[model samples]
Target: MTQNLYIPASTGGTLMSNMPLITSIEELTAEVITDLLQAAGSLTESQHVTAVEPVSFGDQSGLLSYLYRVGLTYSDGAQGPATVVVKLPTDDPNQRGISDALGFYNRECTYYNVVAPTAPFKTATIFGQAQATDSTDFIIVMEDLGHMERIDQVIGATLPEIETVLKALAKLHAVYWGHQDLENLSSTFLPMDNPIYHAALPGIFGAGWASLKVNAPDLLDPEIIEFGDNYSTHLPQMLAALNTPTTLLHGDYRADNLLLDEEGNLAVIDFQITSMGNCAFDIAYFLSSSVTSETRAAHADQLLHLYHDTLTAEGVNYSFEDLEAGFRVALAFCLIYGVASFAGWDSFGERQQELMRSMASRTIYSILETNALDSLNAN
Candidate 1:
């Protein structure tokens, strides 16, 4: 049986209406707009949103959510915002099935409503967030950070950018490092020790691997394929080894999910996969998947040291050797996502395909360089 989790939007002192959830952009009616504005604190009792002009938003290819941007005008002839991005779950049955199965939507909603207030790192400000009982019907209305310059994952990050990301991530990890109360949090934040994840990940990896082999054969080496094939079984022990002194992980921490303001401060989005895990998981995932192979080869050591130094400065007590070993394991663990992303190659255009290929190349290279497969199997 699947459990349902629901999180109501932040009402910010206003009474919430019993409006039907907005599941798609087409359903963004005037009443829905008013409800959202009130919940987001953008409208007071004296002010009301009279109209909305829907604007263009994301690439429309998000597997989990559909994004929309809309400008709102108030009754008092004032504009609420130039635009705000509205995120609603993808209506596709297959995609919704995966999200529900993994508790992705519930986790994200929890992040905004429960976690963001105290999180150390910068994330998109949530004006409102809500989910249906089943977690399938959900929406997040947030400040549009689209104006900030975004790094191209295919082009990869520069040395400065890599340093910035590592430092930011270190701060986030340190905040919850070995917090005694973490286990009492929602099951949505559970580490891989949870049986639900142990049961689900293997099948997901196998399906993804099968698709990659069929769709992008040239990218897979036999060693990498075999590593992926056997990974699901080995995952339990490997995750157990890596799970100690756990912290919050920004599960999809990558260039594509990050944006930089004019002063170059980094802000992150997409907490759908946020979980409790070794900090090295995010570190390895970012370094292996978001940067070019050459960039990582050149700066991997320095980057790891930077992350370690930051962690130490924040009063965490892990040694460099510990970090290095966890990093290697994490690099191998990342192959699961690297292969899984290719399952949607047919939906990708030339540039998207190029990005996935580059990520794969970098991930495979890191796995081989660190002898990640051998390490996992040996453990």
Candidate 2:
């Protein structure tokens, strides 16, 4: 579809113009990029600042962003493009979870030594520090993974591709488990009594599953409330079960968050939700989140083996026992996460709401109808 270019004459020289929030691409300059970098704390008081033009991509913030790609030709003539993402601010005032989540992203980089795309920021030019703008506005300068494919595109791939992601998921889970104190990992993971878990809401962790059952009764069985309560009831056991060998699990390891660079190696984005929970939560969430039921059913055994075999290969000492257990416990993880996020899509601009919710509604319907919880439990 051709973007409708706004012409001043078309509106008969109105006093106001409905230009895109960010300025036109041709107007990007070194001064603009320098200002954005400084906003994110990338430049010092003395350093020369210059920004090339910016190109933007799909981002969640309502603010339009321009990716300013520039070359810093230094005094010694060494030059390279400094890729910066410029976002002025978002319009969402009541939004929550920006700080701790960005902290988690930075905190994960501290342990995992991996670059995080979703929450990239810098306190200094050389080191990474998660910083937020005071007025719910900011820009982020990040590493550009040149020509890498997004995980979203590869998700519908053949068996081997799925295996690659599963193995990586297991490895991530195993490597970062128990590296930090639970309080530091996620207050949400600790019981509500834990004061650090203070501001956290138990809403999404399990309640939304019950609410969805209440809201969508025609499509889902009311018995889902039983499953939801079972999850809440077994919270202590679930916490105890977290004692199983842990690693840094990518909380949202869906295809959309994984990037394939020019070399086709996987680079992950979105560190905002990184947590110290059981590895299976991420594995099961990633495996189940985006696909259709027919696809999931057809590929079930093959993909399970991919996850297990990857764990086994990495010497995680996983078995069918571990996989099934993870699979079962992770079911609630998947269902509830879906329910918690449903409203976001429902209100996205009409087309966005349509596409995102259509897929999501199908996912929810399929999950309930397929008895993902029951099947995982049965296994």
Candidate 3:
């Protein structure tokens, strides 16, 4: 008997039906493609896939998954999508082990299967999603956003673009603000203190710091490193702060994960790190990692206030003062990525290296500006 995938149908969209777990792009036969399209309600019974061509997509830096752009043709002499994106697990044993241990693959599969349908902001529409019971094998067939322009994290976003991101985030936070339903999804969406996260934290932070110290020494301030070393001791307080009126978070909400159309409408991708957390973590992560120090300095406060006003307009009772405090605390949390990315710098190209460097620098700056360490150290 086939095991039932736990996708909730209440959110109202096409749900994956009878899709098989695909471990690699090589497994995608024409029959499989047709089945996927049919399952997503994209094709009628008369329609069938005639041909498929898979090509590598973007940077091959994703540690846990391989990405492909698949071109297709229909059997009826009809042109189908010029291309769709497919995400599959990486073959590398070490990376795969890390991903499995940390539950990254399962989290993303659950997001596409359930959470994305309920999100207020636009995200890639899933044509197919499946994962193994062990979470070692997974695949996601999604709408191709290749034609859209992606914001470059190294170059940074303009003021208007940042405002757009903040508005989108506000909508997402408002919709799920203080919703008790999040607790019901705990198995799929882990909290910050999940044992998997705890198991992986030391290695991730240690490797990231070692990399930053060796590859990009300038970005690592002595005080920042010191703060990161002691961060674990403050976990209890940090967790308490994060649990204050929880909301859904797009954990890695950076410029690189967002796509924009000509009209500047945004669509997000990469839900591998999606979780339940304070909305401030997303806000702080975006500003610190996606924007340059100068841009953040000039507009961070105004943009933060924009998020507050937007949430207020949506009937959320959160105050600007509380939001500001959360934002400050969340900056320290952003250091996790700053350190980890620097550790894995060689996996990225020169452009990504520069982006990671900027991210680390700005993250440290934000932490200091808000006296984030002091707040964490306080009773």
Candidate 4:
């Protein structure tokens, strides 16, 4: 059954956006959408939304959110976006619990609302967004960049693609490197050393480790298991190390979340885990998890130098050696994501499972090749 809500846009602003607040997809009626778009000044008074067709994406799309690509129709010959993407909180209780605890919903909504506009790199254009103070309820409607090329994280990204993302990252980090407004931003974008994360992530990682032992035992050998068991004990010290040289980190930077258009414009998505940390965390995670081990091994030095040089050119004075050290620390920290993926192993489809396997293997390989574990204990 289709809903035909006809409320005026003037009645909808509730601190998040002037868009109609919709907690569920069923509430996204044409009349409601028309009103919101009108309030946003995206549509003319004579134009209105006529129809909508929403298609749900799978877990491979994103584990933390319920994603949909909504096709739209306009009243007559009115011109507007042909489609838009909608993000809602995940229905899975386990994932939802983690998101709620970590403030993922608010972080993403805040990113789209504040950071995305002035970010050094391209991000999806926001059409409307609404997030509840309760943290469990939120919705974001944005431009659909599905037509852009996305590198397959399962197959791994090529050197050119990796370089492209790294360059963009350097620009982003440089802009925010020791910026004055960092303290103000902390209210919405939690610092890497936030107490809430330190309290919650250990248990989350441990849950993932326990789950992996049952479902994907082969991925973790005795050595890795030993490391996993001790991860919580070392987490505080590790996060302390990651807290310096603070800048905005995309937090979940990787191939799956990056898209490129024909004109070579790159757009990054999925800011759910955005945080304030040493930019190396983003660089290390991308190199370790998104690119193949073989590719990383062959070009690791050159790529690291590339990022450092780019940052240097932008007038940041960090040394290559210190950046390398930070990179290693971040690589050791990267295991949490791979280990955590298995917490909901049963729910992931084969594609997501394959991507996780690729990420785990690559991350471990990077850790070993760089002796990242040694950095954790470095004085």
| Residue 88 displacement (Å), model 3 | 0.9
Candidate 3: RMSD to truth: 4.5
Collision count for each candidate, in order: 0, 16, 0, 0
**What ranges in model 2 sit over 4 Å off?**
1-49, 52-78, 86-94, 97-140, 153-158, 177-201, 205-219, 225-243, 350-379
**Which residue pairs does candidate 3 place in steric collision?**
none
Can you write out model 2's per-residue Cα lDDT over 1-379, one digit (the tens) per residue? 1112111212222112122223244544555544444454555444545436444464453211223343443223323335543323233321234333334323332322232211222111222122232222223344555456665422344455566667667665544434444444443233213333222334444444544455455545555556556655554444455435555455666666666556546666554455565676676676566555566667777777777776677556667877666665665546545555433433345543333443345445545644656643553
Every candidate's lDDT: 0.77, 0.47, 0.77, 0.82
> Candidate 1, which ten residues in sequence have the lowest lDDT sum?
1-10
After the best TM-score superposition of candidate 4, give how far the Cα of residue 95 lies from its true spot, in angstroms: 0.9
Please identify model 4 stretches exceeding 4 Å from their true place: 1-13, 59-62
Per-residue alpha-carbon lDDT of candidate 4 for residues 225-311, written as tens digits (9 for 90 to 100): 777789998788779888988888889899989998898788999998988988889999999899989999999999999999999
**Candidate 4 clashing pairs?**
none
What TM-score does prediction 1 earn?
0.90
Candidate 4 weakest lDDT stretch, 10 residues? 1-10
lDDT, residue 31, candidate 4 = 78
RMSD of each: 4.6, 12.2, 4.5, 6.1
> Which RMSD does model 1 reach against the true structure?
4.6
Q: Model 1 misses residue 208 by how many Å?
A: 1.5
Q: Is candidate 1 or candidate 2 better by TM-score?
A: 1
lDDT of 4: 0.82
Candidate 3: tens digits of C-alpha lDDT, residues 1-379? 1123345533222223346776678888778888878777778777889888999866666256889999898887544576789998877555676677767777787777777777767788788777665446777888999878898888888888899989989988887776767777666677765666666776777777777878877766778878877766665567668756687788889998988899888898888877787889899999988888888888878899999999999888987888988888888877877877665576677766766788888898888876877777676
